[model samples]
Target: MQVTQTANKNVLDRVFKLSEHNTNVKTEIMAGITTFMTMAYILVVNVNILADAGMDRGAVFAATAIAAFIGSTVMGLLANYPIALAPGMGLNAFFAYTVVLGMGYSWQFALCAVLIEGIIFILLTITNVREKIIDCIPSVLKHAVTAGIGLFIAFIGLSNAGIVVNGATILALGNLKDPLVLLTIVGLLLAAVLIAKNVKGAFLLAMITISAIGMVAGLVELPKGIVSAAPSLKPVFLQALSVPAEQIFSLDMVVVVFTFLFVDLFDTVGCLVGVASKGNMLDENGKLPKAKQALFADAVATTSGALLGTSTVTAYVESAAGIGDGGRTGLTAVTTGLLFLLSLFFAPVFTAIPTQATAPVLILVGVMMASSLKEIDFSDFTNAIPAFLTFAMMPLAYSIADGIIFGIISYVVLKIATKRAKEINLSLIILS
Candidate 1:
């Protein structure tokens, strides 16, 4: 009887271990799903740029999607952080629409720029100067960055939903008199209702449900006809390399590099600080474990994306949505990374997720961002002015970093004028 009891105990212990392992795997999978849903918007907009670049549009897209999958997956499993990576929305537009078309630079030259910028980012990560730079920013401005991004994201949602329309000829700035706008408003209200009712995944589920209803009601446009779809497989990369080696080494290369480095640096910093705080990743000192490792992952992802013939890579703030769903660690990141890989097979499906559907998630994100205003030390004008400058400039200046710079300058100026120079930290003043 004693031997039998021992055997049974051993079996139960093994079962418990198996169950624990399964739970971890499930958590990681959930994280990946959240990550993929956040990044789906990129597939819609990025394809247009590659199509115009005189490169094989199909190949460029395939490579981009693949690289995103690889980069995010690696970041999740290795760095164990819940951040999503993809060809950044703004950088891609700048690369394709502005740099290549607007400035008349060749696509090869653009790729070179991405490469150079990515390398610079990597070096910054290795030296840990990036953290120092982030540290030097006034805490008020740091808080403002998250809130400003939230507002900016909400603006993007409203604009995408067609709820904020252009004016007619006379007024030239009135609301658009469109049915799509009305439909989206209805959807927003529905989302609010779901949240009020305590529905889980209220934001995401509301967007999907409303979009499906819109489609059935003839409020949204379905593709007109069967489009010639490309196969979802990896094709030859570096075709641009064959075109001309000499063109890669040009003055244009310098511009591309700087653009990639500058944008990704601040962008990633904002995401890390923003999401980490929300996710409870920060320690008592506000430091995160392996933070430089995570930054390195992001820099490497951007460099890889450029090599894959896409825009500069960036960390997605949408990863916060997963945190909202109870994601606590790297398990969530691994899940997000796996979902990005799976998305390649369902590219067309991802393409079909309407902008209206995603808008609400961003709206919710905006709300989360605005939650920071309470943290601002509004009692002091020195803190208040800089914080206010950062918050207001995000949308008006049309750049987050620009707003940050304005806030820093204003804070320093205000402190000096108020005879509070001693209160100002030398490191912050110098860096700002």
Candidate 2:
């Protein structure tokens, strides 16, 4: 037993640089659990969304788990970063609603476009072009992106908990009388208190406590079964690769590929910068070390997701939860990946977790990340305007890429109008 323990410790220390990052195995494991619990909703949500695109629900479930496993594992091992990757939410919605339904393309064709986009990403990363783009981002904007994602995540949590509802004019308060919403409020308060008290594992404890209460109160249902065999992926995997030759060269196909590539590029960049800033992982130059590796992992995940029968895969912003839990190394990502693998067999049990339980964690993480806003120079109008737009537009527009687009455009316009064009780099001008 002692020998086995020593061996495991050595491997973790060597592979994850655990000591260098000031994280221990136990902390990484806990952070991994916290991160997984917060984002696990994607497994069920992805299946439902893709099924709308006429894919098999069971197949998509297995695909989602597998893609997550692959993405997280690659990120952990290759990038040595705590970030987790999965089939992204908005991109999946685009695949279902716009690409397949609106454009009237087959699901297989959409997968082909995703695959091509991933290839493009790989080429860009290898050529160091993507790294240049990341380097061009102003430090102020990076801080804003981090805070922006916090608001975005908080918005998601509110929507999930039914605290924010769709109104005739805009978003309105949900029914305060609703039991689930009430439970979520209680959970949020409990989490906030624990966080304030500096309790370890506060987020995870809150989730478990709320989930248990939900189950007992009949707000959440118990799993029907604990374990089940995974569904076959051969059917969808083969279908994705069987793209027609004519479709490959079609103008519509080019447009679809460009759309996928564009969205994934900015989304990954925003998430990387945001989560890195929160962890203090960015260097003095405002660049993430091993960024190429992170981008490469995302590219590989997207390609692999296409083959595994899912939509575009990218780094998840929920990684901030792990970072907030003191996950400073890849070991956290590895733990999350391992858990995803285990979840493949225990899908029913994991899917049973109520959104109200996870919602509190998201809100708390948002609060943690929003703290980065203090780093921005809010006194300067030129800096403040773009920063505020980057911070607000994320949740408001319901798209990270769109928020980034608006931020960059505004930043460039303000700089040039103020006759500070020299402060604006050539790359920013080109990007604009």
Candidate 3:
């Protein structure tokens, strides 16, 4: 047993270079588990959201897990980065609500758009255009991106836990008297306290604590079954490829495909920038290493996800949680991928982990990541204004791509107006 264990460790070390990244097996595994626990909600949420577009719920469920597994595993092996990928939250809404329901296009048409976008992404990565664009982002804006994502994540947590809700006032606090909200507050406080004590795996511990409390308090329902039969993917599989050639060449197709390409490109870039900065993975030039491989993995996931009858698969900002938990190597991503595959059979149990339980984890990671704000140089008004807009627009506009778009345009306009065009790169001008 000891020799077998040593052999397995050797293989992991060679593959992930865990020691070189200064992370061990136990830490990476915990980080992966923490990430999977927080992100597992995508399985059920993606299915429900896609179902509105008239897709099969069971098939979408299967697709979500399979896409996650493929994306995360490929990211681990191809790029050796700890980041995990999944069907992105905002992208899915646009696929279902805007493209399919609002625009009256079929879901298959939307999937074709997604597939086209993925192909374009792969091409961009191959040409190094994507990596160059990421590098063109100014250092201050990169830090702002991290802070913006932190705020965005925190807002998501608050809204998910019903601690924040829309009102005539635009935003208002939830009733503290409500049992669920009260429980959320308890979890929030405990997480904060754990973080203060410098506890290892504080976020994971908080989630577990809240889940247990909620179950005992009759808030979180227990799963009906520990394991279940896997769902078939046949209903939605390869439907994207079925779009007629005439439809594919239509103007509507052009517009839809462009929209998908634009959104996925920037959202993935924002996620990579935000989470990489939070994890201190970027170099002095504000560039991530092996970015081509990372991006290629994302592109492949999107194409596969579309073929499997889902929306765009992109790198997730939630990955910062695992990075914050000491995940520095691909081992973390591989572990998360394995869990996603395992979740296929254990869907009920994974789905039963309430949003309230993961709420504290998201909120805490937000606080931790927001420290990047301190790194921004507020002394320069030119930098300050764009940076502020970049971070603010994320949660306010409820879109990471919008935040980046606003920031880049403003930065370029400001620089050109101020006669600092020499400081701007050609890529920046094109991006604007």
- Supply the global lDDT for candidate 3: 0.90
Q: List, residue by residue over 1-432, the lDDT tens digit for candidate 3.
A: 999999998889889998888878888988998889889999989999999999999999999999999999999999998899999998899899999999898999999999999898889999999988888998888899999999999999999999999988999988879899888889999989987997878778988989999998899898879999999999999999999999899999989889888888999999998998888789877789888899999999999988888899999888988887888888888889899989889999999998988888888888988999999888877788999999999999999999999889998999899998998999899989
Error of 3 at 366 (Å): 0.9
RMSD after CA superposition, every candidate: 5.5, 1.0, 1.0
Residues 383-427 of candidate 1: C-alpha lDDT, one tens digit per residue: 988888887887666666667778878988998999988867877
Clashes of each: 6, 0, 0
Report residue 197 deviation for candidate 1 (angstroms): 3.7
Model 3 regions lying over 4 Å from their true place: none
Candidate 2's C-alpha runs over 4 A off are none
Put down candidate 2 lDDT per residue, 242-358, tens digits, no spaces: 888998899999988998998899999999999999999999989988999999999999999998899999999999988888898888888888888788899988888899998
Superposition error at 385 for model 1 (Å)? 1.3
TM-score versus the correct structure, for each prediction? 0.84, 0.98, 0.98
Relative to the true structure, how large is the alpha-carbon lDDT of every model?
A: 0.69, 0.91, 0.90
Error of 2 at 340 (Å): 1.4
